[model samples]
Target: MGFREYRGSRQHTHAHFVLTGHTSFEDEPPLLEELGINFDHITQKTMTVLNPTKETDASILGDGDLAGPLVFCLMFGSCLLLGGKVHFGYIYGIGGIGCVSLWCLLNMMSLTGVSVWTVASILGYCLLPMVFLSGASIILSLQGVLGQILATLSVGWCSLSASKLFVSALAMHDQQLLVAYPCALLYGVFALLTIF
Candidate 1:
């Protein structure tokens, strides 16, 4: 009888909830709101990509976020696919190599080292212009003068924005052009991928 009472007391003690009010289902955020916040975050990052001259917040740029970049890469590849090109392998290969190379180069160049994921994130974010260029290729032939112009503009935009973000995040004020040179090369590859 005593052992049964002791067992009952043990069960009663273990059954109580440790978390009270905060664990309630009503406090959880709705799905749409969470999605909206994520969208807003992506938009802000894109805005940073678009505006090269504007000072970028290091926190935003240095978080080493990859979701935006992954989406951009997939979008770029998909746009190319839609345009009758199956260069997904080339895209992924170049992106991975470029990010690693840039990470190494930036770490060597800057006092503040950079993360590979950050390099990838910046490269991916900068691909926005490339995405548009790839999309434009779908609608019209990108071999003409107008296509050349668009491709040039897109490459320049991506390169400048990427270099600017890197310089800003790494605090390499004087080496913006130096940073831009390699960025131009990287984005130039994407431009070729779009054109051919």
Candidate 2:
């Protein structure tokens, strides 16, 4: 269907006709006849529209609050299990915490029944940059440039993740937020396995 404006005393709008699936203007004789509109000798125009309020089932998959802290614990535990000695283990554990925390935050934001596009946009512009920075920090650390830089970056990612979690919590209602907590915890456990 398409919208058309009627030039009356007051502005009026209405849908003209429905377009059958994959049917071009040339094939829409019935639609043309019903609307008393001509399909021939008319230019076609394409327009894009975005609905910010549309939510999808995919948004319900994860939660952040429970996942964040659980992930923090698992990462720390894995570092110890790997026999990372002294400060080395602690550093690796902290890095894991940051990555997991961000993942949790993303999950939590999704549970609020918000628009999928908005959630995707936020993840792309915000969460992705942090992940990239943390990955780069890990690479630099492996290269033996400066250990402190890696630590700084890892902690920075965690801090940003935590901040996003808080924002998502405030934006969503209490009951909905509570429901997503379990999934977040599961995410944390799974994340730990992946890292180890």
- TM-score of every candidate: 0.81, 0.26
lDDT of 1 by residue, 63-179 (tens): 666778889999999999999999999999998888888899999999988888789888999999999999999998999899899999999999999998898889998898999
Shift in Å, residue 54, candidate 2: 17
Of the candidates shown, which would achieve the greatest TM-score relative to the real structure?
1
Segments in model 2 whose C-alpha atoms lie over 4 Å from true places:
1-72, 85-145, 172-196
Q: lDDT for every model? A: 0.87, 0.36
Worst 10 residues of 2 by lDDT: 41-50
- Give the alpha carbon lDDT tens digit for every residue of 1-196 in model 2: 8889887795323433333343346655585456533322111100000111223222222321222223334444444344332333544454456445545555565454433333322322222223333344333433343544444443344334323433443354343334334323433332333233
Segments of candidate 1 deviating more than 4 angstroms: 1-39
Clashing pairs in model 2, backbone N/Cα/C closer than 3 A: none
lDDT of 1: 0.87
TM-score (C-alpha, index-matched) for candidate 2 = 0.26
Name the Cα RMSD for model 2: 19.1
